[model samples]
Target: MQHILNRMIVQSMETDRSWFEGDLMERFLRYVRVHTTSDPHSASTPSTERQFDLARMLETELRSLGSTDVTLDEQCRLIARVPATGPGDPIGFMAHVDTAPDFPGEHVNPCVHERYDGGVIELGGGFTLDPAEYPMLSRYTGETVITTDGSTLLGADDKAGIAEIMTAVAYLTAHPQIHHPEIEVIFTSDEETGRGMDGFPVEKLRSGFCFTIDGTDEGAVEAECFTAYKATVSFTGYSIHPGSARGKLANATSMAATYIAMLPRSESPEATDDRYGFYCATEVTGGISKASATIILRDFDHDIVKRRISYLEQLARTIEGSFPGGKVDVNVDRQYLNMADFLAPHPEVLDRVRKAIAATGMEPVIHRIRGGTDGARLCERGIPTPNIFTGGQNLHGRYEWIALPAMVRASKTIVNLVQLFAG
Candidate 1:
């Protein structure tokens, strides 16, 4: 362990000299500047052509680092293998290369706050990440942080994960005598647009177990995620002139609003935590002639998730038939299921991860993910994957920032897991 740590420290020191000090921040800037945001409407494998830019760059880096079978597939997913020092089940590190479409991820100007004083750090001249406004910043006082320049998102959500993985892989490859088992490295595209693993081949991945380095804070280890379902409600109402529409007009928008009002206020993302479930009204648009609503139901409990979807469908049916001339359409789609159901059967994977985390001199916090992750999908596909932290906060917004020390810790954790699983 000490030998491995010594190698990591030396490699990290070398990385610090030429963009290594700012390597993660610089890598993050280069990636976010390429405009790799996915389009939900596009049919392409990557959903965006610009994603190929980062994909090609990563492929080059992997090859340069002596990784074998480094290839960027037609789907824009990059895969490579680092030969193990001894016989052991392959371990993998995974992250997405795409940013969310909800924000402008292109031309990102990432700014560094060196030795942050834990105050309101201005991004540009206008936007700022104030500790008072965001108390999470207080946790990283005296540590270097990376943030955006108020023009675009920093893309640290997963880019941070990418950098951490890259640095760890580079560390292991540069020092072959560190005694590690077979390691697989994967970077997927279009994670933001909900199709991250749409075409993912789980059977092809050679890892016995995996963990996503995509959580907030340094000590959080997420083993479960919400079972998510989407419910769409469409309303059809009679369109009539106001003068003669007194009893004829169904007012679909009003009915939609009524349905929204009926959803329990206490059950919302803002009102819940840990194992609590919620109904979130994501989008609503309507008129007297037609109206539609998109709602998301989330919970960790399979039964609760099922009950919420049923409640939504039943309510929509009642609302649809409420008026003689009014009609409603309801569609419920199961987006993803909780991984705990599958992971419980594979307790060894969790035990190995817990052991790896504890070896880092930090107590592991095994918490449930409030939102679904690609790991949830991977678990369902056969690999019982969990989530580790990337030390990022306020993801998907301008307030996003990452602590440099925490990022280093993440790299160390990855190395520890690889060694612990190595035979």
Candidate 2:
């Protein structure tokens, strides 16, 4: 069944991509033009109304492809299903629609270098993507590279994922005899703000196992991710007149800064690599009377994670002990755990994925992710999912790019995975 489906997929791919005459760069440029940057400050489901623009567009595209049961949730998560040819568990391909909030996602004009000749690819005067600075540029010497216009982010961090998934689905739908299983497609909102799945109905997702096509590089595959937790520290202090407040008043801002300074300088995302754990302080804001700080804790090992949490608890206690009557409130919440705990038991999933990659004649580089993903939460929700690359590089930045051939190969790999599961 696998061999037969592969032949069919190859044949389907061979057909001139005339239908997909829609250029990915064109779609990506249009998507980036829309202001869909998620707002961590907003309380709304999507966290921003602009994200709906992309959500609605995807809904229409899916419906146009004759996909059945296409709909968008209140939170703006676009869900659709392409019925299975016969019988098999549904597999979902998920990607977020929102761009990162760290950078501007507005007025993005994507530029394409047709047949990149290597060397310095200038974004503008002075600012350029130099091969020497980013050695990765040397690899795409002969490929068409898409980048931003030096102002706003190219939004390829995810818009690339959306386009690939859409193109693959469009291909699958157009070729009915490809012999594939049911494909579940989900376009999530607010992923940039860590709330894409906040309102997602996991039970209604309709897929036993899913894969987030959100990885970097063409052949990269990930089955493990970080166990993430968020820690918050609040400091309350007595405020008095500045001149006479030296000993009588405690400055909350100073207290918060002190706590942040106490964090281990050698143990952070920038300082740590591989499987080593680290604590990252993301936000700190406060005034004289009240202050708050947010920190993220991550590790691959559950035992090590627990120990880190205990350390954080002790750190908070020690800070509270120093303030005498000052109030120190500490809150630690578990965000997501590593999916490896679940994927480990099901070696067949990895076996099938390995075979799929091998079938594509590409070397699969299996590595543990340094960050968290929707797959980690889904694993906790009883669905063992993994991460697959979309051939994108330098994600979440203005210098982001994706190779055309890599995108084509990834789509073929997706087709192969479906065929393998169909068998």
Candidate 3:
């Protein structure tokens, strides 16, 4: 039945000039329903076993798409090699299968609009997707826009990316006459938790450059991202009965709250945009006896990142001093560095992205990622990967949406990027 539905969809798409558009749309809808939300606290490679669901599905799909050397490793990275028609080293395209844990990722019911009317869209749960609130939707008017039902995230953060890659792979297999070099297609897991590239085997890639299809908006190209750090502050206190509590009992929860309170509201994720960096408190948990808080510090400048780290360390000491009997510990873990330095030598990497977007008839908008992508670590590891757009909006939330036409353009951009690499 599923195969029949797939064939029907493809057959319907055959009527369209860009046959891959229907495939990209269906692929995204199917992938998001698989429940691949990742866990941040998990020590495992994928951070969640369920991510294997999409990985396994893509592995089989890639083989069926005429892709060679397809492999889904234990770490939940599904890689496939598209044999070269001409001759050159393979260039890679990547996206993540895992959805963000910030919102409900399971049982996603997407609302597909054939042609938006440029009015308010009533997503359920009293959440209305108003064009006034999101000016980006104005551009999507009169287009096929996919959105959440207001119950779960649309998961277009990277599913749209996955769909674009899959559609491009399908396009390549269908059109062998279009000259191109060898292509590597990679889909990763746990990207939402910022550990997608953990122990990434750089040796696996034969590509001199890779493009991550994980950006938002149309014609977006990103070559840089914030240097990220994971800082955990642990608070320790004495657990005592309320009858004997008084001043003798030191409250760890209070200490954690105090530390959080010390964070500047003006220097938070909600407070900043573009190249400006900030500290984000992701998680806080504990009782009076023990507790811990997880905060992510990000800056485009390494020196600023260093200063942020130092500030956090000093803040921990201050909290300890205030608690007296309570204990505070701050552990800062380097996540990924700014990819700009690593990619500085390769101007063509970004140049080709511009050319590709231009070939798709859109003006490429170059920007910096306020957050990081799997390509960030890959860039630092010598692949010199940059990111291209996936047509996503309001990512990681129930209000998330995407324009189907934009993703189709992105797929063509990938095809163009592949050909440019051959040249």
Candidate 4:
């Protein structure tokens, strides 16, 4: 019976050999297993030392693949150059290596659901993914999908992106006669922490434009994304004994609550979508003596984003004015700018992606990312980077998953994109 099962496995492999091309699935599995979660609170370059494990592994793999000019810097950014054959414009591909801190990114045990039937799927640890909640699962019928064991996130958010980019690198290397440009591939660190591109050696890149393989949905070509900022609103107040508090005490936490109360419910993330900007309070903490809240502002329009920041600053002042002994301080920092601002002038950049997606028999989706990627920062640095899909869904969570066939199409899209740049 065991021999019969082995023969069946061999037969399946023979029938679906194309699905395993470039070892995309195998690479993704290996990458997700590594604990590379980035810390948003850390002041370090990678935000976590564990990220270097994957960085070193990728460096070694690139060396073994005969890739040249490979380097892993102090910031944990890994870059590898694929020499051009029959020269054309240099192009680049990027993907982040660190998993999100939104959930447990350690001990990622990926489970393969072969030939999914578009139904509720069981993930261990008392978690089950329902098609009713995640409609995207319905689209993967008849395709192999990967999910976690419900203990931790699947890490498809960027690991899958890394796998797809590596597949492209491997393909372009073996098929040197494919007529391509000098390809620069980078694996970024701490993208989930929202500061991955900080100190990234963008000056070293030869590509005038690049694509970040950090998007969701199959065949997605993203040029628009949120212009992001993180704001910390801290409050200070005088504390007194309860008997004397009535007239002498200024409660800092109450001041914070007042500021939060002033935030418009209609203008929040839960209430907005598709080009609508939002102010989301991610963290709130303190006692009567001290209090603070972390809020993120996001919008597509530069003017609107500025207005939102102004609103935050004004609100802080108003909150302070309400209490004579209370002080409120708002500090806003730019996270990333929208990529469309840089990519719009390059219609040819978008056109090439559409053609490549079409070449893989999938219609290209001109998408707007509600969040940002490493591409946004690269674009800001004059690289004009856009985003491409990795066929991931429910990203940054335990319910995350990806379609095997979708990844194959994406891999094919990258191959075709490289050729399209040849002219």
Candidate 5:
């Protein structure tokens, strides 16, 4: 029965010329221009009001495309169902609506280079994406590429994913003869701030399996990701007049600096890659009397993350003991864990993805993500979700770009996955 449904869908798609002419690039460009950068300091679900702008737009677009159950929640998460025409388990595709706050995401002007020549492409502000520096450009030599004007990030990290998912759903909706199970498309907000799934109601989704189209590179599927923790260390010191301050003053700023110095320099983010762990000091601020530092610990091994937390605690105690009149406090919070642990038991999840990528005429490139995605949190909540690529490069910065042809292939991969699952 499933095979029959798949065959009918394929035949219908082949007969419909409009299915191949969907405008994925236009959707992506429209999304990136909205300036939906998430804020880490906001105590809200979306972390930014502008995120709702994109959410509302996506909600309207999904309804126009004939999607059912299309709803945008207060948290700025937009979910809609592409109703199935045949029997199969419901599948979900997710992508975040917010871009990273590390760089500016306002007033984005995208540059379209049709049939890119393999050479140094000059973005404004003296930033050039040289093929010698980023050899990936050579691989995308003849393909159309979309980049920023060196003033703001392109937001292609997940917007490309969102566009691809939207394009695939639009195609599936137009061709009703393409029989498959229901598909839940979720556009999340604040993924860059690490709260994309914080308020998401997974039980309501009813999807047995899902995919987060939030990674970089083409043909890459990530099943494993870093176990993460965020740590805050605060220091209190005695303030005294410098003229009579001998043995009477302990500087809080100095204490914070000492704690950072104690962290392993060779094990920092700039030094580690490919399965190695890191302890990074992300922010530090305050006066001599009081200071605080924010640090993040990441590793594929849960035990290593625990060890890093213990080390921070031990360092805090040592600093307190040395400063006689000063005090130090350390707090650690678990963010997310390696999705591989949750996905390992379910081999079919990734196996199906491998087959789907191959169906797009590309070999599946299996790799572990050095960072976590919203999919990791979903997998922990009993939904087996792995990550697929969005054809983005140099994400979270002015040099970010997307290969247009690769983006098209990613959309095809989504369509193929639906058909494969139906069978």
Candidate 6:
């Protein structure tokens, strides 16, 4: 079985040079055109009704590609099975269907630049992606680059992952002699809003482990992620007319501003990198009578995250004392935890991924994810899932872009992984 898998890798390498035939890029372009931005405020499974549009389309595509047991659940998660030709543990591949709510994800007009000249790309509306700012652009000097028209986010965050997974599954289906084991492909919704795996049917997947194709750069394989929590601080103040506001009136907005100002400037998203954690204020809105601020706290250390939450509660009390008549409320909710905790017992899962990545002629770049992925939640549920990149950069914004050749490499890596697992 190992010998057969080795020969298969060699053949796949030769065919991968032109395997896509433009299908990968076409699928990505088509996906970004649909508006599937998730809403954080919604309590529904998908968090957005429009996510089904893409889910249904992917279901149709999966069935047409000869997939079996395809199912689109009520949560808008699309799962399918590619039949096996050999005996091995079934492998699972996942990617999200929804875009982030940080930026506009509607009417995305993607621009494809073939044989990029390694120069500054001017994406209209006075937005230009300067290579000097993002040196990674030079790596794909003569390759095909895809970007947004500067009006909306490109949705490459996970859509690029989706396209790569689809392309890999299609390639396997076309070549019946690949000798891979049964493969499970899943497309989840509301990943951006952090509820991606809330409705996931883990028992039904039946795979020993899974990999989430949702990261940046081609060689990255994320095994560690931050423990995440969301904190909401509400301030209630007494309102009075301006003429009598001297001592009786307490402004809620002013109290909220004070709390924000008290946050450590050194412990912010812009001030940290790598494994460093930070507290980020995502939203703040208020008037004279009532105001609320939503903050996202993250750290790789579970204890540190708890300390951060405690600090927030203490700060809220201090603010309440400063304003005699004002009341401050702090609420914290756990989002997800570091996958490393769950993955530690299953080092073989990451080892296999590294070997597969190296088989594609690229060094595996193992790194810790500062932000959470669906793998974090899935791993907590005993799936031992990790993240793989999709050749995307500047995700969740208009400057987001992807390299077609890099994406091809990612797809090739996926194919190699399947063969390795099956062997």
- Top TM-score model: 2
TM-score of each: 0.85, 0.89, 0.83, 0.87, 0.88, 0.85
Off by over 4 Å in 2: 1-5, 11-33, 238-258, 286-289
Model 5, C-alpha of 337: deviation from truth (Å): 0.9
Stretches of model 6 off by over 4 angstroms after superposition: 1-5, 41-45, 101-107, 122-130, 234-263, 281-293, 313-329
Tens-digit lDDT track for model 4 on 1-423?
A: 011112332344335447554389889999999999999999989899999999999999998878889999999999998887756888999998899999998989999998898889999978999999998888888878899999999999899889988887787677666667788889989998878888888889989889999888897888999999999999999988878787678899999998988988999999998889999999999998999999999999989989989999999889878887999889999988999999888988898888778767788889888988888888888999988998999988988998888787777677778877874
Put down candidate 1 lDDT per residue, 42-146, tens digits, no spaces: 987889988888889989988988899897888898989988876678888898888888878877888878888988898885987889988888888998888
lDDT of 6 by residue, 1-423 (tens): 452347655565667676573879889999999999999999988899999999999999999999999999999988999999777889899999999999999999999999999999999999999999999999999989999999999999889999999999998898777778899999999988877888578888878889999899878999999999999999999999979788888899999999998988889999998777999998999999999999999999999889999999999999988987999999998888899998898787787788777877788988997888888898878788899989999999999999998888788888888887776
Evaluated against the true structure, the overall lDDT of model 4 is 0.86
What would the per-residue lDDT of candidate 5 be over residues 1-423, giving only the tens digit for each residue? 343225554445445434443488789889999989999999988799999998999999999988889988889988999889778899999999999999999999999888899989999999888889889989989878899999999999789999999998888776677667899999999989988888688877978899999888889999999999999999999999878989989999989998899999988999999989999999999787999999999999999899999999999999988887999999998888899999889887787788777766678998998888899999889898999988899999999998887887788788878876774
User: Global lDDT of each model?
Assistant: 0.80, 0.80, 0.86, 0.86, 0.87, 0.89
**lDDT string, candidate 3, 261-376, tens digits:** 99889889899887788998999999988989999999999998899889999998898888778888899998888889888888777877887787677999988877777898
Give the TM-score comparing model 1 with the true structure, all chains together.
0.85
**What stretches of model 4 exceed 4 Å from their correct place?**
1-22, 117-120, 130-135, 236-251, 286-290
**What is the C-alpha local distance difference test score of candidate 3?**
0.86
As for candidate 3, its clashing pairs are: none
Candidate 6, poorest ten consecutive residues by summed lDDT: 1-10
Query: lDDT: which candidate is best?
Result: 6
Model 2, range 1-423, lDDT digits (tens) per residue?
454345555655656344443445556556667778899999889899999999999899899888889989889988899888756778898888998988888888788887899878888636688789878778888877877777778787788778878887877777777677799998899888888776478878888788888888767889989998898988897788899876577788877888888888888889999989898899999998999999999999989878877887777677767765567787989899999999988887877777777666578888799888877788898889898887777777777766666666666677778876785
Model 6, TM vs. native: 0.85
Candidate 2 weakest lDDT stretch, 10 residues:
16-25
